[model samples]
Target: MITCQDILELQLDGVELIAGEEGLDHPVTWTYMVQTRPFAEHMNQGNFALCVIDYVRYDFEEAQRAMEELYELGISGFAVSVMEDREWIPQKMIDRANELALPLFYIRWEGASFVDIAQSVGKIILEHEIQNKRTGDYLYNLLFGYDINDRYIEKISSQFGINFTNPCRVGIIVADRRYGINLEQDEHIYEYYANYLN
Candidate 1:
């Protein structure tokens, strides 16, 4: 659940918030560069739309409309680059953003480009998703015997740098619920077990 606030922590240069400060905590599902397409098919809940602002630079109404449309689709937020000596973001756009509680920000892009921001954010999200998938698979296998074949086992072991030939054992540690082991604690325990097995 990486949120706009998480992305902001990266402190990208030239990027500034124009409105919707309250929406910073909303979780971002993915980041994508905006294109001419309608964006309905590509947009999903928690999407962060990144744009160059070239298309709506001259039209304030269009920019406001675009923000409203994106908000309707459950987009997490929007990021736009405001190049030097170019048109600035419209006040209406900022107003609409605050009204909708959608996070909106402008990137100065002094030397950095929109692609750089998109790539960095996308990479963080991609890695998070991959880690989550691996966790889910590992938990599933642990709870329900290894329902996979040998080939699958070999692949998993190779990916995780585990040697199948070595002695392996699974230890189930039961925690007292009264002690209140949170999810973060569980992950640490899992990690400890994984390292111990290796």
Candidate 2:
């Protein structure tokens, strides 16, 4: 789970958290740039929203409303870059963010770039996904490999932090024709269930 806290840890230039400290652990699935009105429609759950205050033309009240909508949409976090006149995010907006436990970030426009922040976050998410795939492959090998041995089990256990020393059980679901409903006839349905179970 690549999270808001993980993004902050990157310490990107001119980026800092201004509110919603308690929501730092919110998982971020992707990044979104909010340039149009009704931005919630363009966003999805676990998206980290990036916006330029001037570009959005949002006043304090409007910004607060947008934040509430984003929170309702399950946005992971919000980052706003302000123009020189504003200098900082409104205190009322900060208070509302704290109350909602929605991570709010401020990016100084002088030296920071939204592209750079988005790219860094994207890289972290991709790397985490790749690592998960590798772990899954290792587990698959451990379950079906022909030359499995005590040494191999121990190595895999240690490498993946699996406590194989304890009792464990594996459950398999076999899909077949039942009551005239043939699962094999529609592989998509079977795959959907397999992914859901996984």
Candidate lDDT scores, in order, read 0.70, 0.78
- TM-score, one value per model: 0.65, 0.79
Encode model 1's per-residue lDDT on 129-180: one tens digit a residue: 6766676577568459745687877777676555569785766555433334
lDDT, residue 109, model 1 = 53
**Model 2 Cα lDDT, one tens digit per residue, 1-198:** 688999999999899999999999987878988756676556667789987777347665666677788788888999888766365787888998899888999998785798999899989988876766677688888778897888878877787677677787776767542434443334534543343233
Model 1 TM-score on a 0 to 1 scale: 0.65
The per-prediction CA RMSD against the true structure, in angstroms, equals 12.5, 6.4
Best by lDDT: 2
The residue pairs found clashing in candidate 1 are 14-108
Clashing pairs in 2: none
At residue 41, what lDDT does model 2 achieve?
Answer: 50
Which candidate has the top score in TM-score?
A: 2
